[model samples]
Target: MKSLTQGAHHIGLTVADLEKSAAFFTELLGWNEVARNEQYPAVFVSDGTVMLTLWAVKQEPSVAFDRKSNIGLHHVAIRVPEDSALDQIHQKLLAHGVEVEFAPEPLNGGPMRHMMCYEPSGIRLEFIWPGE
Candidate 1:
């Protein structure tokens, strides 16, 4: 069996407001929209390479992120570039009162960096720099 079965197909994120959430990703992460709203209530976005699809959930369900109660998935990791950029984004997250799960850490030996945070509905998200 293939350990990873090729690369990630896509990432699905449930959000309160599809419009707002989609815009946030496009703005903050510079992800361009590849497809959107073909399903009436769902929005699909991409960065010309990776796809990020957002589903509008009427009532967001409890997630493991709330307390490791819900199971199956832990979080989604996002790749970034610079450590300083991660630190600055962390500051903005704090200002927004976004739930930050931990302090940023150096990844891939040292240069790469990462931080964990929760979306409004308690979905764990990891922002990282996947070093070469």
Candidate 2:
């Protein structure tokens, strides 16, 4: 039998506002908006490597994110080129008024550095630098 799955093609997120969420990923993460469909109310952004699809929820009740209680996605962890990048992103997130879950710190003790924050749609995002 052959394996049917390949690496992750994209991640789709349901957001309150498509434009805001699209801007958030583009401005902060340096992703590029590749496509948009007003009819489906979906926007696609790419980091030049992976694509993220943001879908606008219509007439649906909004719910707060609770990692402890929710059974679905916990957070999306993105890899950074260097440890210094984490610090840079920390400042950018702050400037954009995004909530930083915690300052960048060592994950367990060796060389992994990471920081956590929430996107505009209440989705948790993590940036990590494995080591130099």
Candidate 3:
């Protein structure tokens, strides 16, 4: 059978604050808000290639994300163009008062370097750069 899936279209994440999460991605990743829905309480942002959808849940209580215990997403990793870009983002996230899990470092003693952090809504995000 022919492959039905082409590639990832978008990633939908549940956030406590729609505007805050939207702003975070826009500022950090340079994504632009392309669409929004008040009824669904979602904001869609894209970096001219991939789209990320942030869904707001005001009525429900927020639950902290636990990668080990949770059955869902562990983290979302985005690729950076260069090794220095990872550090650049790390600094910006710190300036924005965003929580940084750790500074950028070599991944598993390999050429790849990565840094992990949490978005405003408590979702773990990773920025990685694979060495040349």
Candidate 4:
């Protein structure tokens, strides 16, 4: 079937701490804060190529997303230009006290290298570098 969409325009994520999550993209990753909505309490960030819309959770007792059972987003895998970037980001994540699932290593015995970790708001992120 012919697809209507060209590619991803943006991604919206529901986070427990909107400020911290926004800071993750802006402060840690050095992405720019494009816009914000006080009414919905959402922060929009962009890294020149990709944009993320972080929405704040309204109430408590919120359940965390389980990739094994949940029928939602499993994880967001971001690509880096160079292989060393994975290690660099891993170091930054560790220095900042972010939870690291694993260090940079061969991805499933493949040529690509990747590392996984949880951001401040408990969202799983994977950083991968395509070796060439």
lDDT of 1 at 28: 57
Against the correct fold, how does model 2 do in TM-score? 0.92
Give residue 100's error in model 4 in angstroms: 0.6
Worst 10 residues of 2 by lDDT: 57-66
- In model 4, pairs of residues that clash are none
TM-score: which candidate is best? Answer: 4
Residue 31, candidate 1: how far off, in angstroms? 1.6
Report the error of model 1 at residue 50, Å. Answer: 1.8
Please, what is the TM-score per model?
A: 0.73, 0.92, 0.92, 0.94
lDDT of each: 0.73, 0.90, 0.90, 0.92
* Candidate 1 lDDT by residue in tens digits, 1-132: 758687777888777767777776676567787777756578888866678788887554633334356555688787766667688778877886778988688766676778899766566789887654
Of the candidates shown, which would achieve the greatest lDDT relative to the real structure?
A: 4
Q: Answer with 1 or 4, whichever has the higher lDDT.
A: 4
The digit string of per-residue lDDT tens for model 2 on 15-99 reads 8878888999898889999999889999999988779999998766877668899799999998898989999999999998999
Give the clash count for model 2: 0
Error of 3 at 14 (Å): 0.4
Candidate 3's TM-score reads: 0.92
